[model samples]
Target: LRLVNMRFECVGAIDLLEFNICNNVEILNCDFAPADNDVVSAISTVNSSWLTIRNCRFSSPATDNGFDYCLYAAGGSNKNLHCALIENNIFDGMDGDGTAIHIEALCTASQTVIRNNLIMIRGAGIGIDDDSDQAMVIENKIFHNGGTPLDVNASLSLMNMLSDDGTVTWSPTIAGLSA
Candidate 1:
């Protein structure tokens, strides 16, 4: 219940912000726009923990629907979301499908930390489903997306720490990432 520097604009497919079982929830410097185009999720948290979205800005509904996720952290009955920190956020234009950021936990989500964000989206980027565990995606700056910025299916130690210092950019290329 601690929303700081708030600015939420919703006209149509609205869900500018949603919460549940609030813990240390802190959304700082917020600016979210869910202006129609159906399929909504500007920011959503179910079974919340130490959820902290920093320096935020998100705008969804560009093309597709299926509820474009600007930021959604939904855990299971165990409410596994812990130590969550989505840092320095700036997830721009996402308009189709989904996956600007979606963390689905069931068996894991112990130290969920997605760092230094700046994603210019088209849909599908950063999805940590399949029973998330010690997820820590670091130093992010994804561009012009069409899936696969970091889609870890989780389990079996899928701790892919991608660091070439390029900050993740892919325009037309998608095959293995790195452009």
Candidate 2:
């Protein structure tokens, strides 16, 4: 499946886009704006492989409860994501306990690449959270988030990244990051 050059505005749903058991999917140059504060995610994927999301923009409203994510990818017990590439996207206006991008339950040693993105959120949320150890996060600009900019569970590599928390701009050095 391929979705290109589209605009999704004021979409009132749990997930504006959902993909399950899909392969070779591409979403490019799209814009997403959730309706009010009732939306959960802009895009969600389950058991998908070889997915690419690039050059997209996502915006959310400020909510008390806070939504889940701008983009989420999850694999089941039997099904696991093989490879996913998310790059050159912009995620903004997220608040509370939400995440801009969340990747979880990937296959062992499956490589997921997150690079060249701009993520800015409010409140105590995360910019990127990867449960898999095989993620490569590089060249992302994260600003004004109250929580961790990049959170990886195990050994992953992060390079050429910039993060700011309104007062300080610094590069985080992670232990066990491979060269």
Candidate 3:
């Protein structure tokens, strides 16, 4: 287990973390820097049995990325990826096209749980694409994006999305996303 926050760098500073990782890690109150550079250095590519991201804050306003979607899962998508937990993180202030605002799994990522995250993006909130299955997204607040809140274009069996207040709604605008 590990944790990172304001103490790691100057306030409003930008940093990047890259590598293949394992084990449990937490990021909180970390204002990803370069202040609108769009280049996301703080990313993880992993073969780990499990991964967890919590209480982090990412801000970018460039065309490249304040976030990257493809790096999180080297395996494939939600269906093939293993356990991952993302909780209470904030991805906002992005003006460009990021990799993803939240999570994108082509595999399924069994036992995957995303809870209480706040995502404000120029495009895309949480996207689970390509034959994914069985994920729980609960208590997340998403708003003001060029795209939908939760976008799942594949298949799922027991995927659940709950608002912070414990309520949800399904929409017809998106193919297979609810609440």
Assess each prediction's global lDDT (C-alpha) against the native: 0.63, 0.73, 0.48
lDDT of model 3, residue 156: 36
TM-score quality measure for candidate 1: 0.28
Better of 1 and 3 by TM-score: 3
Clashes of 1: 4
| Model 1 C-alpha lDDT versus the unseen true structure | 0.63
Residues 88-133 of candidate 2 have per-residue lDDT tens digits of: 9998846577789887745432777888899886677888887765
Query: TM per model?
Result: 0.28, 0.83, 0.62
Which candidate gets the maximum TM-score versus the true structure? 2
* Deviating ranges (above 4 Å) for candidate 2: 10-13, 61-67, 105-109, 153-155, 166-179
- Model 1, residue 11: what's the lDDT? 69
Top model by lDDT, which number? 2
